[model samples]
Each structure stands twice: as C-alpha cells, then as structure tokens.
Target chain A: MRELQLSLNQTQKVRLQRALEKLESLSSKANSNASVTVADSIPVNYEDGLLKGHGTSEFNGEVVATVCGIVERVNKLVYVRALRARYKPEVGDIIVGRVIEVAPKRWRVEINYSHDAVLMLSSMNLPDGIQRRRTALDELNMRSIFEENDVICAEVRGFQHDGLHLQARSQKYGKLGRGQLLTVPPYLVKRRKQHFHHLENYGIDLIIGCNGFIWVGEHVQVTDDMVVDQVNKSEQDDAKPDENSISPEDQGKNYTRQETRENICRAANAIRVLSTLGFNITVEVITETVDLSTSINVAIHEMLGSEFYVLVAEKESVRRSMTKKK
Target chain B: MEYVSPEGLRLDGRRPMEMRQIRAEIGVVAKAAGSALFEMGNTKVIAAVYGPREVQNRSQQLNDSALVRCEYTMANFSTGDRMRKPKGDRRSTEISLVIRQTMEACIMTHLMPRSQIDIFVQVLQADGGTRSACINAASLALADAGIPMRDLVTSCSAGYLNSTPLLDLNYIEDSAGGADVTLGILPKLDKVTLLQMDAKLSVETFENVMQLAIEGCKAVATYIREVLLENTKQLEYRRGI
Candidate 1:
C-alpha cells in the first residue's frame, strides 16, 4: 500500500486553524485577504431598507468595499474584495412590492427597493410565449387578471430607463391573496440556507421581498379529498358500506390511492416552487398549504410515500388568475 | 502598585485570588451571520460570527474539515495609547491564533468544509486579560450562531504577586511585574484547551495560581451562561413563539 499522508487529529487541527486565522487576519489588514463582499454579507441592508446611494449606479456588491475615503452622499473605493455587488438582476433575490395600476395589456408592480416590476399583457398564454403590445380583449380581461391592493411575488426581468421590470410568469410566483406577512433582519434568512433542507422538511412556502419583507404560509387547500376520505374510512370501519348503502358524500370519497396521491402531489409541487424561490415560514404569505397539508390525516407510512411538496406550474399567467374577490 | 494587599486581599478589596465582574451577551449582532459580546471587568469585546457561506481562498479550503479563522483586533480607542492598526499585527495575530485554537476544540468543523466561519473579536476597552475575554466572547458568539460545539470555552488569568496568587488580574496586576498564567478550559470536560505563561512562579506557587485561575474561569463561565440564557430568552420572546 502507498504511504498515507499524516493526518491531524481534532486538537492539532484546532491549533492549526487558529494559527491560520491569525495569518488570515494579518493578510486582511495588510489588504491581502481581498475578498468578502455582500449579496451575501449580513444580507439585512439589501433585504429590507430602500437602497439609497449616489445616482444611477447600483452599489456593486461583488466584493466587500472598505471605506477607503468617506464624504457626504458618496464614498470612494480604495480596496475591493470578492463577493461584490453589481447592478442588473441576479436570480433568487426577493423584492417586496404592491400593485400600482393595471390594464388589459399589462399590470405594473411596484418593487420597493430597486425599480418597479412590470407584468406585460401579452406575456400571458401566447403561442410564441412572448408578450407584445396589449389588446382590447386583454383590457376586458385585465381586472379578471389583476386589480389594485394586491401584493405578489415576481421575478426581476431587466433594467430600463422606466425602471426595473418584473414578471409573475410562473404559477409559483403570483398574487398573494391571503396570509400574514412576516419581517426579519434579512441576513438571518441568507444564513438559513446553511442547512439546505429546512424549507423542504418543514413543508412551507415563502416569498422574499427585496424591500426586506417576507411572505410565508402553508399551501391553500384546493379540494377536501382527505376530509372526504376520512369520513368514508370511518364509515367503512363501522359497517361495510356497499354502493347503494353509502351516502352521496361517501360515494365522492372514493378517490383511488393513486388519484389521492396525485392531488397531494400537486400541492406539494406548489410548495416547492414557492419555497425554492426564497419563500419560507418567515412570512405571513399563507394560502392553502397549512389547511390542505395538515388535513392530510393519512397514516405515517402513507405520508412517507408522498413527496414533501407539490410544485406549482411555472407560468406568467398564474398571478393573473387570482381575482379581487379573494 | 500593589495588586494583592498585606491582609491577603486583592486591589478590588477581595482576597488575592479574586476575579473582576464578567458579563456577556450572545447573538447580539442580528446583522452578523452570528455574534456575541463579552465583557470581563473593564475589558469589553465584541465577537461577530460569519460564513459557512461560499468558500473563497483556494489554498485555504480543506477536503476533510472546515477551517476556523479568528481575528483579534483592538479598537483604536481601546488602550490608553491608541493603536494605529486594529489588526494585522504580530500581537493581534498571536492572540487570534490562541482564540481560534481554543474555540476549535468545541466546534464541529467537519460538518462544514470549504466554507469559513469568521470570528472577529474587537477589544473595545482593556483593563486587563484581553485574551481570556476574547476567547469567552468568541465561544458565546459561536454558540449563539447555532454552531455545534462540545462545550463552552471559558478562560481566566491569574498572577503571583507579593507572596499571594491573584485571580482575574486587572491591568495594574498584569503590568505590575509578576508571573502571569492564562488558562482556557472546557469547564464541563475538565480539559485545558490553551495555556500560556509570561512570568515565573515557584513550583508550589504556580500550582496555587493555576488553581485560582481555574476557579476564576469557572466563575466567568457562570456569568457567561446567565448572559447567554437571558439573551436567548429575549430573542425567543421577540419572536413571540
């Protein structure tokens, strides 16, 4: 066998690490540890507060910038580290916002921090899958699509003189009709991804707002199949209910295990898209997740067989489906 | 310049083996990925915890385990004579190394490699025993950050002066010219993680001073524990769960 390299036990490693930390610190003050910027820095500054800085330029966060020099309304960069910030959108950043106005052709969303998020009219259900200018028919269906006083999850499209554009093109990202909103110091949320499985395990949904507010909740129940099934199971336990003997309610309860599984699978899918896009229990963005998922009174073994979350279909028209009545 | 009095009492009117007040607050830096601040007498320190994020520094990443990085910095305003550089100096480097080693014993680093957990300790003020205070602060901050650790690391320093051993030496005792020993211990495990001495003491007297320092550390741990509990309760209560 080849000779193995000497390995460090825990104690030795600790000692080594300490020495290294000293070295790293020395290097850093010497301006050598040239990395550590935000996007991931504590995260709170970007998450909640409306960003205010010198004109048009977005604070570049690709690397952490030290105060090389300081003055009112502006600062100078002396040394730059990695993990810097840049303008234009990166994927997976939460933006807080509300609906400003709507038309058959398009709906405009107001993102608090960077720029307004726009929902183009033609983006919905087009053959080419590309939205163009709005039409009269879209005008008629506009309110049917969206109205005032609606808060939503939208992806940042791009930047323009008009402002930052937004799209709620996916079924997962849409109008949050119901749920309480929760706010926290943004950095904690960033650090949370450390475990990488908290969202998946907990079976929750989340919507991160760039303005630092969060919308979170369990999924909304689409149908009461579990409730209906439970009643049927209990009836069966009491007596053998033949087709004729069973009531109308009992008859509707007969969802095959596969069909029942499909329904739950759909909800779980919805939870994933929401959670994956940076939504978690940190917000009051609840809908049907809790009611339907919790309504799943199935046995533990059966639950295990089911997927953790039923992902929602990613689509631009998804948010348009939510009506004012909700 | 007497730290231990003729009556066997220390400068603060206690016995020669006495510790100054120790106070701590854990998880205080909400913006930091994790943090805690500890105060030993007039020596106050703020320790911030960050990372386990995307790993940078190719040469630094390890295949088998995570690396612990500590930076012990002194604020410009901390000492009677201002420090021009808060970090990146020999003295700070040595202290930082000691803290990192002492803390690593308790941390479960293999859980997160390629990622870094940066513990930065800034001494806001120094009355005495800055190193011991820094170690205690880092430990609480690590625990507050929810980092896995075997036990809390607590430290205290003792010195022999005028025939009596003193616990928790203040600046006066430390600079007064005597034998000084600082010990970092995992109180529950009864393990000594870091030990260093700067002056000399007789064999029997050294033992006495060491024992006094260990006791002082035990007391500091109690104070740290209370502060941590109070801080956790405050955070939990704010969450209103």
Candidate 2:
C-alpha cells in the first residue's frame, strides 16, 4: 500500500492511526463497497439499459472496471472514477500550465494532460486588452507575452483537431508571476464554482488549477491600468530622456514585499501538508490549515514536520465527523 | 544435483507444487505516476510506470493507439557474482522486450491515442524467475497508475528438474540445466499472453509443467487483486466525501 514515509514518535504514531481510523469509519458508512479494482466486475442491472463510461468496459456480458477506482452510477450511466491519475481536462475548467514552446501562432502548454494544450495567439486577449486579429508582428513577439517556462493560467476552450485548446480571454486569466507552483494528484481537486481565490488578509492569490498545478503568489490586481501605464510610459520616453534611466529601477521596484512572501510560503506549506496527507484540497481547508499553523505559532517550515501532519489529520477527522452528524 | 529430495521437498524445503512467498507494495516511488515493489521469495523487483502523457519522440507517436515502452535493469549487487554489467545488456534487453509485449497484450492502448506509457523495472535481487517478478511488478505499477487494462497480467515460472515439475525454482535449481517454463497469463480473461521455455522437455511433461505454472500465475493474480483492492479502499476512505 502507499504509505506516508514519516518518522513519528510513539504518541504521534498512535494519534495518526487513530485519526485515519476515524476517517475510514466515517466514510465507510456512506459507500463502503463502491471501490473496485482492475478487472473486477461491477454489479449492474443489464435489464435497465446501462451505459458504460470511462474506466469501464463490457467483458463477457458483464460490466467490468478497466481501472482501479470507485464505481459511480449516475442514473443509467455507470463509470469508474480513477484516483491519482493525470489531469483529464474538461471544457470551461480553469487550469494553470507552463509554456513549453512558443510556436508560430500558438503556445504549447503543458497542463499535465496526455498531450500539451494549444493556446493560440488569437485565442488569448493581447496584453493591451484589444480585440483584433493577431498580426505577423504579434506572432514574432509571442515570446515576450509568454516565453518558454513561463507559468500561465487559462480556461479549457475545448478540443480541436490538433489537440486540447485553451483560452485566456478575461482579465482574471493570464500570466501568473511571483508564485510557487505545486502539483498534487489531480483527483484531489474537484471542479468547484471558484478556482481562483484572493486572500485579502495575506495578500495572496491562490489559483487552484484543475490540472493539479497550484499558484500561490502576491496578489496582482486585475485592471487595465497596466495597459494605460504602458501607453503613458511610451509618451514619457518621447517627452523626457531621463525617464528611461528610471525605467530599470521601476522594474526592480516590482519585487514582492518580505511580509507577503512569507505569507505565500506559509500558504504553500499548508497546501503541501494537505496534499501529503491525501486530503481534499479546497479553499476552506487550505485557509483552515494556515490558520491552524498560525494559531499554534508553528514556523512556516515546521508546517511540513510530522507533528503538523498528524495534527492536520486529526483536525480533518474532526471536521468530517462533525459534518457527518449534520 | 538432485534438486528434489526423495521426500518430495525441494532444496528450499518447498513442495513440488508449493510456490514462494509473494509480497507486493504499491506507490513505493512517490514521484512516479504508478510504482510497486514485488517480491517472490528472494527475488525482488521494483517497477514504475510513467506517462500516458505526451509522446517524447514525434516520429514514434501513433495516431490510433498509445505507444508502450519498457526498460529492464539489474542492480550490480542483485546477482551473487556482483559483476557490474553494462547498461542494456543482451539479457536485460530480451527481458525488457518480453515484458513490454506481455503488458501490451493487456493494456487498452487504443483508448489513449497519441500518448505513450513507459514502464521501468529494476531487479533489486535476483534469485530465479526475475523475469516473472518483473512482469508482475510492472502489472501492479500500471494498475496503480490507474492505466486502463483489459486485465491484470500475472506471471510465474515452473521448472522440470530431477524428473519432477517444480513450481517457482530458486537460483541454484535455475542453473541446473533443466527446462524452465516462464508463463504470463491474464487471469480474468483466461488467456495466456506469454509463454517461454528453455531446455527441451518431453511434450507430455511440458504440459504438466505449464499447467503448474498456470496455477502459480492464478495464485499470484489472487494476491495482487487483494493488494490492489486494499489500496483502492484506503485512497477512497482517506479522501472522504
């Protein structure tokens, strides 16, 4: 079995075991027999005209699971939901990716999918927020917009003949900077109404990519001021020669503050702890973890320590049990 | 050398039909999409599966099906001789081919078009039946990685030694210049995906040995199913609703 590789003291080990057992008991009452392994047949009523979905197949007049996972039934359709698999993209889901190649008119993005997604130059709103056909000059300057290895956030636009396509047409979706990117198993992240969260208290922007790539960074306001600023900077350059000298200093001034950086690390560490414990990562759970660490006065790095892991497990168990009672 | 004693016990004190202790663990490699450590007696193998992701080589990408690749390696200390074998030796390459073909027969490659799945298995200890152990490990890793397969492929080796068909030989009996039959089977499908034998045996005796190997494979399949079920349960319960 996959186990957490941790060195825990005697009491901590017992506590972790107790918490896990509690979690098991709480969930087992709901759907204890829903999980199935490969080649195991799912008991379905053939008379009802069942439809087999992904991770399931017909074998010798029986519906058998093709993967190791839980069997889900939605009315007449039955399918197996695989855990710990790669990100399976769905249209309209928000995702974070890394630019692997700046192609002629499209940027090849790695979104932890079977194939790299194509983000066309025409699909995304230009940095200037203008709506026009991408010109040859824009194709040549694609690297300046999103060069190789630059992290990007976009929405799944659907599949095309070439491959999966993504678009960033809104101000909320675009280049992500000043952040730490984390990857957990894609199954941990469910499709929720909101994937982008701006923690006003910590001044951190958390973009929970459906593809399992998470970005925690200093918040950048979503506004058209950057475009106006660019336009004014050009005019300033033509009007005054000395403004050019201060431009480089302006680039240096974009650095994040020390306090905000610490908060980002703290939030990132909380996520790491949650993913390691195999907990479902939601905005509420993440903030609760961060709050737990702060309330206990644990150092940012200590959030990854074994004690914190045990504590989180206990807290999650308590949270689930309480929710179950209602 | 008499591998089977008059009392019908083999050198390892196992009966002619008795197989070695088989143990399997999943997710040993944290970074791998799917990984497993499988052991049969003194033989131990670790396998990791990556991808069903982007195909690395553009020329090798298949339009209608996913490309499957495998690599087999043995640690320097895996063998008793402790010789440092060169990478991709002839033996390892042949075993890698055998494992790849065996796994390809069961995986539903057609479902994952234009992608590639890579299986890497390394022998940590070699007693006998390392090939079979590697195949079993690869199957577990593939299933653990949540790759779609028609059925779990399990393999076992049986040997004809000293006028007896022994199930799961060890290193000493393996080098006895006897007939060793390595069999891979899809238990649920009741199909044999791989069958290889070395050193000639009578046709009638070969059937008995192959049957014994099939039995061993079924035993392995049962154990693997239990392990996989337990793993699935743990993951589901831990990630509560």
Name the top DockQ candidate.
Answer: 2
- Model 2 misplacement above 4 A: A225-227, A230-252
Instruction: Give a tens-digit lDDT track for model 2, residues B1-241.
Output: 7899999999999999999999999999988899999999999999999999899999999999999999999999999888988997899999999999999999999999999999999999999999999999999999999999999999999999999999998899899999999999999999999999999998999999999999999999999999999999889888996
> Can you write out model 2's per-residue Cα lDDT over A209-239, one digit (the tens) per residue?
9989999999988888556778766866775
Tens-digit per-residue lDDT, B125-203, candidate 1: 9888999999988887775665545567899998888877778888888898888899999775678998999977778
Best by lDDT: 2
- The window of 10 residues in a row where model 2 chain B has the poorest summed lDDT is B232-241
Each candidate's fnat, listed in order, reads 0.00, 0.84
DockQ of 2: 0.87
lDDT of 1 by residue, A1-326 (tens): 00112254666455534543333333334332222111111122344333333211132342221211111222232232111011124444545457778844667775533234566755443322244566675567777656776776666666655445666554455666434354444322332321111133344345555444565444433334435566666776776645557666555444234433444344344333333322322322223443344466543233322232221111111221232114
For model 1, what is the alpha-carbon lDDT of residue A73?
A: 21
List candidate 1 stretches off by more than 4 Å: A1-326
